[model samples]
Target: MNKKNVTKEKKTRNVIIIKTNRKKRNPTRTYETVSSNHYEMTVAGEAMHVTIERRKGIVNSSLRLSTKGLLVRVPLDLTEKEVQDLFKNYKDWIQSKWQDLLEKKKRQKNNKGMIYYRGKPYQIKVLIEDTIEDKKERIHIDEEAQQLHLQLQSTEKSQWREILKEELRKKGKEAILQRIPELNKGYDYDYNKVTIKDQKTRWGSCSGRKNLNFSWRLILMPPTVMDYVIVHELCHLGEMNHSPMFWYRVSVMMPQYERYRQILREEGTYMARIIDEVELLE
Candidate 1:
């Protein structure tokens, strides 16, 4: 496989591990158990609190059946072994759910790419009708215009989406550097790195290491939205958390901080989903 494909495979594997870890560490406030022959294992999870669900409604009591291990509701009475046996019987089904959950977690982790002015995913296909190419699936870039494009080389082949995503990150950093000073007249902060990512519910994050990450989807939003994200992360250099004092600092920097926060809450999700989606190859 090409490097891009290899990187994508690694990212996919990591996402799966992240989802499984999340489920294991999930803590909630509700717990209930249901019994069903359809269940494969004594799966314990928390919607609110730890609840054991038992699968039911199978034709054969010994026959294990499953679709995906969704948090289902059933009656209580099935033994833990019965659930385990059921899971063993429908391992593929369980795996499918596991994969779905992993994807969902990935989307959530990146905030669905909802708040971007410009950015790309790991892999993206774009048309540059003006350019000529020897091969359909060749890597193409126009340095002067700062444009990168991709095409599907083979109908049956899968390509890494990370290249486009990485490009998006690079562009996003440029955007931050260019806009920070303009947005905050005297904005001065030392940041280790400026990067863009797919976030589920946050516009930006600041790590103790002085690295800043923003949702690339923010590029798709209005300029005001993008400015808000830039200022927010920069402000983190001074305050690491969202304390009242932090908000006051942010307000001093941007008088309309509340307006941007409201816009993000109300419209950010739709924007994030744009980059989170994968278009099928023809």
Candidate 2:
């Protein structure tokens, strides 16, 4: 070969060696689940289930207090002693949150005979009238008396639940329709349509087509909280994503949006649970 050919071959060989060395210096990372175990813990004099899950690629350990119980996620490489130490550091937080959870559960269970309308609680009264036509039920609201009267033609008590839910949906739609235009008066956002839904997990949603959807359970929230949700969805018409600009738009309309957001975060689960129980009633 010529001298030029030899020089080119040497340069190519050096480049190949450099690339191979770089690859060896930085190895790829792979994650795997190591082990999972369940234990019991005492929080505020109550025994609770604690689930510990060890997984790879976790740089930090975290403790989460959920409806079911407490969950701990730890690095797979952490030893039992290290995990226990971490848990001890978060013991106070766990206990405090667990106490709050217990209280919330108790309050949710006690809301059985009450119906929340426009943030006010009303006593529910079911009156069955067999003389009326079959499959006909009417809901009467006595605002001054703070009571909801359901007159059902069917004698089966199970049928009243469905009638009550339907009445709530009608009331929710009427309230939302009235509130949306008042909220949009000063804003530039325009919505195509509004829908009230029986959503399982969401309080409200905005579509790309400018349609808005809200949960019927929104009627159970305080007026401020319900207004915040409406404004939040309206702002979505201007900005679809939850970027800083979208939140700024929401804040422009409702300055106290953060306060209502916190209220929803704190009480949303309990309210949703109550709605689910009502839905499940036969």
lDDT of each structure?
0.52, 0.70
Q: Candidate 2, 64: how far from true, in Å? A: 1.6
| Lowest-sum lDDT 10-residue window in model 2 | 13-22
Model 1 lDDT at residue 202 = 78
Superposed Cα deviation of residue 138, candidate 2 (Å): 4.4
List where candidate 1 sits over 4 angstroms from the true fold: 1-170, 278-282
Q: Clash number for every model?
A: 47, 0
Mind giving the per-residue lDDT tens digits that candidate 2 earns over 1-282? 112211221111001100111111224555556788998978888888989888675444556676578777766655687667655645676777788888877767777766666666666777777775554446677889887777766665677677777777777778888888999985867789888898746989999889999987777778888889899898889888899999999888888899998877787545544544642312
Per-candidate TM-score against the hidden true structure: 0.43, 0.76
Cα displacement (angstroms), candidate 1, residue 278, comes to 7.2
Count backbone overlaps in model 1. 47
